[model samples]
Target: MKGRTIVLDHIDDREAAALMVDGKLEDFLIVGDAPAPGTIYRARADRPVKGQGGMFLTTPDGPAFLRQVKGLSPGALMLVQVSGYAEPGKALPVTDRVLFKSRFAIVTPDAPGLNISRSIRDEDERDRLLEIAHECMDGSSYGLILRSSCAGEDAGEIAEDINAMLAHADQVINDPETEPELLLEGDGPHVLAWRDWTDPAEVVTQAGGFDTHGVLDALDVARGVSEPLPGGGHLYIQPTRALIAVDVNTGADTSLAAGTKANFACAKALARALRVRGLGGQITVDLAPMPKKDRRGFESALRAALKADPIETTMAGWTPLGHFELQRKRARIPLSEVLK
Candidate 1:
């Protein structure tokens, strides 16, 4: 219960991982039946959706939809990667731009360049990483990116990671097979927990770590419609057919700034709730009845809170009925569906 901790375990026969910060569940990931994002496939184009500038394809997993495709005729074979999860009754989202991602390096087939993460501000570290990239990539045409996690890591390890990713990219890109197939399966929850949770934490890899560390209790709270926010306020997260509806309640905090406190609390907790539950797409928040002048402050607070989130989100601004909106990417299957 002190510092950061990670618990890797299986829940109901599904691979699951949890990131706990000071004993609270900060993030969660679990395997679902659908193919995870980053899965590579040798797929064939099927049909174009008129007026949408998109095309449908048949992948090894199932049907996939690619956007902004051109010069591709029906039955054309090309490599595609899963960009994100699909909505209910929708085609799996995919893209032609394939990327091989690891903890320390990323191989980009579409973009050709060698770059280091801007977060590595130390010139010496940047130069060292660039040397490793150059040595690993050699004269390859594919682009290589040294991720921020490489900072302070062993040079030999970094070089090894680069070489591994390069090897994977080559194998997937030059399969020489003309038939549709699953070239590479996506990284699972346990692997992703090691890759993305870079912060220093105590690792728990044995089974039942979830129960031992209270992750199961946290998940049970996450499954509920109402979420506890700071400052005695709370919010209900309900996923409907069209969008996620969140209603804020002050919960007996009768103070002069009660509305402002409740709204800000909701703003901070909303993103985390959505992330923990793997809910995405349109999100509409009905804040407490605060003065309209506080709208800008609320927006700034929400943006700041969302900055730490890895998923792509767009603040769609306030609506006519005083509700705030956000367009979030569907990067993971909904937890309710996955758990059920």
Candidate 2:
């Protein structure tokens, strides 16, 4: 039950809802209109476009890009999963690998395997979960991914959930009557926030009288503005066309210990901000100058902070100018466009 609260509020005169976690605006989700991520659509592959390396597919949500169309040919029909929302002037990214996710696990029909969350750092727990996954899979040909939320759940409950999801996926995939339509809508911003939280009951939904302050605050941060960090420092977050750039600054009068603490604080805050704002792609963090000997400690602290992120992030080490370089997968539309 120890987790952030999710707030879903209907926007006035807009076709979307404002999603916030612990009173911080996360992103906007289309209400009953746009196709959500994870929606399964039976699509017909269109002619392949040169240089894109992927085939265009006619889906229920219109034309979508099949990022990896390995044995697919033009006019062939197959099931495709919506990977992300359709942004303006761009088609939705669909994948052959369809995954059904619940609170604790994911059921992937095309890919049959067992994978544990990287956030599950405990070796013993990981081994136990792997064993449980094997037992739950029980010779089934469905991929089961144990999420971080499965940490403290009962083995029986997890097994039941996975079994049920696999059964549902199998029924949908094998049913001949299922046409080229949306099987299920993907999670909206509010649901995404709920999934990341340790407890779903913490979420609060408001049908009216939505607060706009959090939205404004999130917009400011998304526009690359500086915000105060802990221990008397500030962090400047700027999103450029290429990548996100963050600068950590300590005031001239602050002591070295305070500055170092602020830098660490900035790292943790930056991670949360990225998730909250839905900022993805490459990111660089420029910390206040530290002693050469202290780089290792800083990197370790930053890495630990970034590990909490649900999105796939890779630490690419420090740049030549002593800035930290990291890459994150673009799971959704950027916050800037969502607000617009």
Candidate 3:
């Protein structure tokens, strides 16, 4: 580890080297080359444009893109990005860049069936889906989605996402002076949800930073309707032995009952799970069977306890395994982690 660090607009080689010093990693050396392939495109294909709008088709070149989507199983999630070529165009051979999930046969390119658009008409617009969309689609129509789509989502959102993808494709196409490549490739859902231990308020306002604005908005939408004390924004998300472990420890509210009351405890945990797990649509909750000592008293207490939260929650039934099963809406993230 004695070579100097070298940063670049983009890396040219698949593998690179660096050096470590004094048991501490330098800022320059730290940006190692764990390059994600296929998210960005470096060259314009030798193929010719075929329709009303000039279109170019780029495929996944390295296994990194496919490997990123692969689960514990041998198979992987295939993401086919067909740009330059618009709909009503003839189908052509899949290029080497297009990394198929299992095999090349699984991916296809066709015009999207729906039309979706978003615009910001407000001065203080915090929601910039439209701007993002514009930045994404340099100008032409395109479609794409995060790996989260595996979570039983409807066609509507998927369609809009596809358009958003196309928008991104457009941006890459328009920029010729700069080396065009994938700016932001979607990370595995589990990794993407990792918590950021920082000042929540400042993080929220930063001009450029990894902001959990999407998660925050989703939580805000279901706020009072789901639970009070809208997420403090200081999230401690991380990977653990089990599913994503999201411990919602409070800062100022140090009340003993907040941690001691059965109903309060269950409700708080439930709300945190609902948000952290991102269990949208509807999900089933099976609470640990209330202490057997009180039986009916425990059930009544649990029921009265959760009365304050707002989301449409219900107590289904108990399982023979001593677990209570309740059905809640299936949020996208809960279903998308095909990884395990």
Best by lDDT: 1
Question: Which regions of candidate 1 deviate over 4 angstroms?
Answer: none
Q: Put down candidate 3 lDDT per residue, 1-340, tens digits, no spaces.
A: 2332121111122111111122111111111122221234443333334342222333343222111221222221223332211111233222223421110011112342222222223433312333433444454443322232222334445335545445454554455543324433432222222211101111122321112223223323322223323332122333323223323334344454332233334444454445333343323333322355544554565566446433345766555755444444322222123112
Model 1 TM-score (2 dp): 0.98
Local error of candidate 3 at residue 160 (angstroms): 15
Which 10-residue window in model 2 sums to the lowest lDDT?
A: 25-34
Candidate 3 lDDT (Cα, whole model)? 0.31
Compose the digit string of candidate 1's lDDT tens values, residues 292-322.
Answer: 8898899889999899888889999989999
In candidate 1, list every pair of residues with a backbone clash.
Answer: none
Put down candidate 2 lDDT per residue, 1-340, tens digits, no spaces: 2334455665444444444555665444433445767788888888787787899888777888887557778888888888765546678788888888877889987777899999889999999999989987887888889998888779988888788788778876886853466666677656655555555534456554244335545556655567767667888878887788888888653676765676778777777667656667789988887777877787788788877666678989888888889988766556566455
Better of 1 and 3 by lDDT: 1
Better of 2 and 3 by TM-score: 2
Off by over 4 Å in 2: 1-4, 13-34, 49-52, 85-88, 113-140, 146-160, 175-180, 206-224, 252-262
